[model samples]
Target chain A: MAMEAYQAQFAAHLPKAGPAWLADLRQAAAARFSAAGLPDRKVEEWRYTNLKPVQEQLFALDTAPVGDTPPALLQDSHRLVFSNGVLQGSADDLPDGVRLAGMAETMAENPGLLAGHMGKLAQGQELPLPALNQALSRDGYVLAIDPGISVSRPIEILFLSDGGASYPRNLILAGAGAQATVVEHYLGLGGGGYFINAVTEVEAAAGAKLQRYKIQQDASGSSHIATLAGQLQDGARLENFDLNLGGQLVRSEIHMALQGVGAEAALNGVYLLRGKQHCDNAIQMDHAVGATNSQQDYRGILDDHAHAVFQGKITVRPDAQGIEGHQLNKTLLLSDEAEIDSKPELQILADDVKCSHGATAGELDETGLFYLRSRGIPEDEARQLLMTAFISETLAKIDSDAVRGIMERLVGEWMAA
Target chain B: MLEIKGLHADVDGKEILKGIDLSIGEGEVHAIMGPNGSGKSTLSYVLSGRDGYDVTAGTITYRGRDLSELSIEERAAEGIFLGFQYPVELPGVSSTTFLKTALNAVRRQRGQDELDAVQFMKRLRVHTKALNISDDMLRRGVNVGFSGGEKKRNEILQMALLEPHFAVLDETDSGLDIDALKVVAEGVNALRGPKRSMLVITHYQRLLDYIVPDYVHVLAHGRIARSGGKELALELEEKGYGAFVSGTEAA
Candidate 1:
């Protein structure tokens, strides 16, 4: 069905008694999206990663109820299931002092609270995907942690998309002095082709801590574009790790703003590509205050005709004195046809700040390969070992043991394929 | 156990190891001493089947098989070991893991079951202690951040673990002090047995004093110019390669 037909069907299925505020926000967002349309290569930020596949493709929106959920993908994960766009199921073992539920429930219970935080951090501006998600999203989840609360187990949000186009939106609010870790997994089922356009807005209050792990392992024919925007207040810390292993075409845009003094942010990602798959990771960090620190590291391994793009920009405003930021992007091209384009930029306006950026793209070192081969290891085994080592640095940063194990297995399976 | 008959090799279109011949019987150790650019390193690389070295002429027979026809790993599995002159440092591969893999690979090639982790660790600890290599070095990446002497000792540790039928030590004593040289030489001497043969390549006779070769040969301009007993090494040490080369040219 065309996008217009899908939108009409979606509007008819929404709850009639839904809060008026949410209805108004949805309608306004739809108008904005229709006027702006999907992003194109003409946009500077989207220049390297074209969205033609996502825009041109038509998807049937998954509005039906989600049935039985599959077994937990990883043990020890707190499963929060979202069927179509509605939150349908949740695991019993949730961390203490944490409140998580479907978006509609949260909005109905606390209407003013939902109205205040939603769409505040991610305004879309020139980016159209976030706006599109905000307009078309039916229902999702909200995770909230009170002040001074610390959760030991990771909150797992599983977004299972049926064979239809789905827009999922999440709003995460970490109160002051609260600490939490969450893992958001996006997966697909059945042979139905679908597109997942998602936007997650994170707000870390003063002295709060938030660690997020986003795993994208959708099917080969699926298209996924996610925009994660984070705002860190004074004395707050945010660590985000993204592992993209499976997708036909994936573009992940992460934007962070250190709005308070003494705030710190760490962004790390690893993408393993094979066959004709294409994965792009674009990140931007804005240091708006003084005495802030930001560090970013992303590595990729490309095989066959796969292509990987990494574009990172670090902007140090004039008031952001005493800021220290570092960015590094490195890639290994396993085949002559595999392509990788890395662009790392540092724009500094403060003299007291120290900022550095580096980008490197090359094949595996012949000397290293020869050294391994001379040890009686076969060529394939040697390549596997080196590739594993190449991405181990990023994998080591995951604090959750169970999540790390799952990520490792996923990476191994992708490499073997 | 190993014989080289008129081995001629070239690296990058320039011929080295020109018409060299030598033979090593079981349990015997021979030292090849020469000046810089005398092809001491080239012989080691060619014997190990390293790339970029073209064996344009001659043949090498190991245990009555054509050794030159094998790949590097094949030769390694066949009990031929080459202690590199400048050991390559591989970051992120632990020394213990690397040695265990190589050891098991060779063993499997020889149709033997691999050693269990417990047994491998025990054996590695013993050899590492003998070579005076610290446990920390084994846990870290192979030879990465290791000092010159540490890298040389690690090479000896690998040599001790592999236990090849024939070993080639290329300048193992190049960047070592007196104490390090003694330790490495002791490691080599401890591996000496009736079934093993060694070809020690060096520029100085100091290493030979510890390993104590039964025969010594002078390699000049990629060919063996002179062959003699251990006394020849002493004569050359006293008179230098200048005298030998000039005398050979004059003759």
Candidate 2:
């Protein structure tokens, strides 16, 4: 009843009419969500995640303008802003071969682009969150890079929500041999009693290189749930990094399908949480073809009563022989009350495949602590140094120096806090 | 100047250093030699303020201040250095960064201006060269992938850079070849001065032969069984630790 109440309120924000196929897609998604409702602890994929707190809040749709437009992650980049749940004015200076537009606006002008990738990757109807996101998404962005074109600057989407709810359905389509970077940044506004359920679908065509970055800094009184479904063609590469620094309750699920030979996916993330925060990250790396690679490296630094969950699975199909997949999850527990639940599963149906998974959680190294403090470094500084060292292994994977520097500064701020 | 009066300490609630008394003035270097399990290393750990080496009953007065009142880093800030028997390997922490942080922290504690990067590197270069250490070694993680000799050399390099007034070398000569021994001994011999004092703890007389001390105290069980001049190490070396080890039965 609570979910239904919010769903009706969110539907009022969408236009009354769209194309027939798009309308049909929404109806089917709505039916699926109504049938499934909210997933409970019984759901195997969400065993470590609890939606009870989310169900009780019954967040409303507040249309008032909230929060300042945060500055661009980079000084020189294409920017898009979505206030509450609606897309604001567009970004300027786009390259000649790039098409970036809001989903609803794009449907009216050019439905052909949204026709192919709107719901192709995330076909699973069992997940209620994505189903609800598809049924209600109206103003998410659509970014398409033409074939053989390369965008020099990153495209940033700032989703600022306050006292309300927002459902953003995003699409990132990379043509053959195309390269671009897309950043989905979520910020909370006005003490943030908001709910954000976002779904992003990515299609990396043959030989395309796509880098996706998600920085979730939702407000302390909000719940941010997001899902990413990506499909890679031949020789395509996917590099994704997530920095989860804020939010009271957050869950990010990533499903990557390596459908093309020579395709690769490297998903790395770091969650630095404190207070009563709860963050869950689930990744399912599917190797559908042979000779593909996938790697998942995540680090969690939890203090106070924070709880973190990392569930990474590498599934190799029977035909996906000669594939290499590895995963590692390490956590640093800075407080006795802090907790972590880590499960790394590997289901390899193919022979001659190389796969490995590792998960470790513990406090800071005592010997290393003494080694630093014994030299005049204070206790807190020494702990911060070790925490930085622990996460540097994951941060080193970021190829962009500017992005890495900014992320490092944010990490420092979190440490100082 | 440092003084230890009626020193009693325990490791894991087991008494190790029992009612030991010793005193050293400025410009003095005292060598504590003993057989295995004589609490030689424990005394050094207690002096450095390492946790778990509890001082049950004693007074460690350094420059007329209680050493127990200060923490490990506080002791280091107050010019106390411990050259460990086995130096820890800290991966992912560069020697330059580690040393710079440490030097600045110590400087801040000592009411001295922090060294700028240029000044820090200049000082780092002087000590690395004096210790026969290469510049590349400082670029790598502190003691990471370092050989046994290199770890000890790094310890001495830290000692030289920190410039502690009272130093404790706990088995600093444990695992070095003759060539490395000479290089390390030369590094230690170079730091000797009338303003600095040292307490060298070793199981063998070979190290005492190099970093020659003004006083040699033979420890048996938990207390100092014998104290003599520099000739006492040679006498113990020739005769072995038979008399000292036997004296510990009643100690």
Candidate 3:
């Protein structure tokens, strides 16, 4: 399970079927990952989340077909099932101006399509996990929307982790004036110990808008680590929402580069964790141009010894002016043993900018509980009503009414169960 | 009917309510006037089964059942409602949700069918209109930014909606203006009937002027010092509680 052993073993088993450029790219990334091994507790980024639990697990990249065609989260949409990094079949439906293709099939059929795209965004990432993903990248999906074209149906990708370890590298390209919604759901089948290193890169052109929503419900013993790196152009917008419920350990990092004027980003998520589950949400919002705005709102509900970590940083560059970025994190500790550590950082080098950050962690309001109970509502129902009400504030921002209803129902089910 | 005999209660391990005996018929509206720290609020909380208002030596019988044997919500289901002086603010819960949930819960406890959304809204609209509560207020968070009189009116609205058999108004007129007090008192008056019993606790006579009580009791030093007709409230307002305090201590 040590890094050195896996490094050598992974290198020896590296597939030589790809082109020379891809091979070279993979080698360079592997070298970078080798130089800087997995971050430990001493590292500032990994301080709150202990990676020791994941490092102890041994994983092998063996593909075993589970043949899972699970029900779609949304009633009508495009669905794809990826089991152990292998796409089960081609994408469900196709509309004009939108292309959905698996990585392995695309590489085999049309190598030139991915020649200029793969490893382009992953190479620029700062985290070692992204580097590891680039080095061991396997089959995922690529969703490309044409310019000035808006898609009605959302693109849904169902990721099923059966056994062993897998690295899935995904990409989303939204052309100028394009608009779309993408959903990613990670689910584990059967109880087993595995590791998932996933990375998703998104590029939004000028005046484009894209919303990405994800739900992580892996098995209890699995460790799921994922990074979402997005770059926005002039007048572009990117909205990201994460609903983390399961998994023994989870680290979801959302990194955005606001490189153009009038670009905006909203990073919102919630972690409903219990039973020693640990989830860390790290966000890095870099405002490289003036007139760009961003906001981060995350809620945490920790119960039964669960621990959640939230670290958000908004940096306005020296020349950037008139940028407004704000972040707020609020947590409800339902049990005495539950814990939360929140750190909101604002590094403002710009002379004229508006940035504010705040965090709060507390238990349920006692007077509110008593008042509700005194009205004939049972004690448990009162708690559930209050907790769900607290979380629904952020989830209400979802643009689609159907998705919001589903999310609220899921949250209520979790509380009642 | 409700009965209390030798009721001794404590809050935070300190006895506040000494030996006391009181009785109320099903159709009577009684008022208790007292100075500060006279165990008035403690007695209301104890009757409603609030946590930490322990009854050390007492028997509170409501319809042949011991009040202490039930939980707070159980007491609510048994038709006991306490109108708080300061209504607790629920930041994310809307007034509509709170009212519907409370109504449905009480109905379920009473072995009756829960009202649907349409039925519940129709019932709530009747009370809100009489109390001058806006639809906007029902949509907003409960008591989040409500004015003082608005909060008191909201309590009265809830009392009418729940339709409790025994209602206790604890300092309901403390923060209301004269006009607001009239509105709230009218709302309370609407719900008064032959099957309902009311207990109004306050330190002023202005409220009793609007919703006149059948009987008035002056409390001092954790015991009822005097009992008389509704004229007792007017007398206490004129003379103040100095006489009642010194008289009870000397006795």
Candidate 4:
């Protein structure tokens, strides 16, 4: 079968093994990946987004390191390069009380902590890509913050794919009463066919706070699929935001569970697509305890023949009383051929919980357009203003200035083009 | 100061204003009273250059220039203002910011020096006080969550700030209470001078009490059928529009 070929190719390209547990995890993930294969239209979660483009391309399992990386792409932020899912260099200017090391080094130094939380956040997912990520992931960055410490600067993790299909798995664990912010960026080079299958897991202990930002800006003709899973303890807070501005066909999944009482979570995202690109965002939140709150807001702007899909769901357990949850997804279609499909759902078993979900898909308001035009603003400038305002409402929620500035610039450039 | 010769317009493919003619000189206030569906709104929209209201035939001359060739903003820059019946609600864009932008835009078009923040705020405070609008209204979004009466007063406040040479008030007094109406009319009357002209469009004679018109015209169907002095407004109010409607139908 085609899945066997991909698995064989992937196995041959993986880096040499470092330790027993790391090797065992890679093998198990590969086996699950081969058995499950790539999800198709029949899968309920991926019904709106088809993976045919990814399956049709022949991807090499190994990537050769770049001789000289392009300065234009890596000019803005501090670069953390990784090739073949292995960290190639170290980063400077790191904040105090924060540590970053390769996955192998962390596994050997802190086996108990890694074993307690790694791979536990994404257990029930049947997707082949996430399973493959867990099975074949190699050396990635590991960040650990001390208790009650807050870092002002954002820590950037750059995963680079030079060639072939690459899977970089990252694990982040925040200690009790600790606070920090991190940004995970994925980029590829050249027109050589590439695939980036990435997975990241975050854990926040009691009274801890974590802000995570993910940016997927890959090369043309490249395919990417990523999953971000998080677990929050009692009195902890987590804010997750994703900006998908690149990739020919990209699918992102975010799953969070408020496992402890008084915990809160916010999920915000924005996607800008043009040409023949396709992007999908799927989110799920579970309220397992009482007095927990969750909110999800996602917006998309599609042009040309591009397509976008948003699927969000909130589930409340029987004992999760006094829970407040809400979700909204709105899309703006710019071209006649552009398409957007949004699905929002809520399932509650507790009688004392409040939950609501809404989805809207429409074109620009003619009245609003005329009102702007009547004021002397050009048609193009008026459209740009409205689009910027729509996206800024979500971006303003970010707590970090540097991260929000980078996102605003990126979105502005995309909209201007 | 303003002239409309054989003005014809249509909305959604149906003709609304058919061959209408009117003219107003400087320092003159004219009131146009008409029954419902008499194309008063269509005339205002056409004059302001709002899209979707097709001006198929006719010529509108303002200050010796063809008004149809210019855009809404250009018309605004040329000192032609139209107070909308239903002002737009622009969330996240404060009323003060909107007014400042518009004021500077018009000023820039006229080759006038722009006002800085401090200078602009001073002028804005004076106008707000004259219109009896609190500073809180300017801080909030333009017309968002505003009551009907508040919206009308806001429109007048804008008129006061822009200081247009000629203005077309499109049913601005329809939803206002008596007190709000007097305030709006007072604001208008304060702006009246020898160099300015106004075209007040209304359905009833109540607004004419505060801002009395020098000339009164009755618009039936699409064209003006009768023109007289201010006493004509009282005559139309007492006799009702039945005479005008039946007279037109008979003709």
Point to the candidate with the largest DockQ. 3
User: What is the C-alpha DockQ of each candidate?
Assistant: 0.54, 0.74, 0.78, 0.40
- The fnat of each candidate, in order, is 0.44, 0.58, 0.71, 0.22
**Best-performing candidate as measured by lDDT:** 2
Alpha-carbon runs more than 4 Å astray in model 2: A1-17, A56-59, B247-251
Lowest summed lDDT window (length 10), candidate 2 chain B: B242-251
When candidate 4 is compared with the true two-chain complex, its DockQ is 0.40
lDDT of 1 by residue, B1-251 (tens): 88899899999999988899999999999999888888998898888887898999999999999987788888888888988788888776778888898888888988889999999999898998888899899888889999888999888888888888999999999899999899889999999999999999988888988999999999998999899989998998888888878534321
Which candidate order results from sorting by DockQ in descending order?
Answer: 3, 2, 1, 4
Which scores better on DockQ, 2 or 4?
A: 2
Off by over 4 Å in 1: A1-17, A63-69, A83-86, A93-96, A189-193, B243-251
Error of 3 at A80 (Å): 1.1
Q: What's the residue-level lDDT of A328 in candidate 4? A: 82
Which candidate number would show the highest TM-score if scored against the true structure? Answer: 3
Model 2 residue A265 CA deviation in Å? 0.9
lDDT for residue B182 in candidate 2, whole number 0-100: 87
Which clashing pairs does model 2 show?
none
lDDT of 1 by residue, A220-245 (tens): 77777888999999989998999987
The TM-score, computed over Cα atoms with residue i paired to residue i, of candidate 1 is 0.92
Lowest summed lDDT window (length 10), candidate 1 chain B: B242-251
Minimum summed lDDT over a 10-residue window in model 4 chain A is located at A70-79
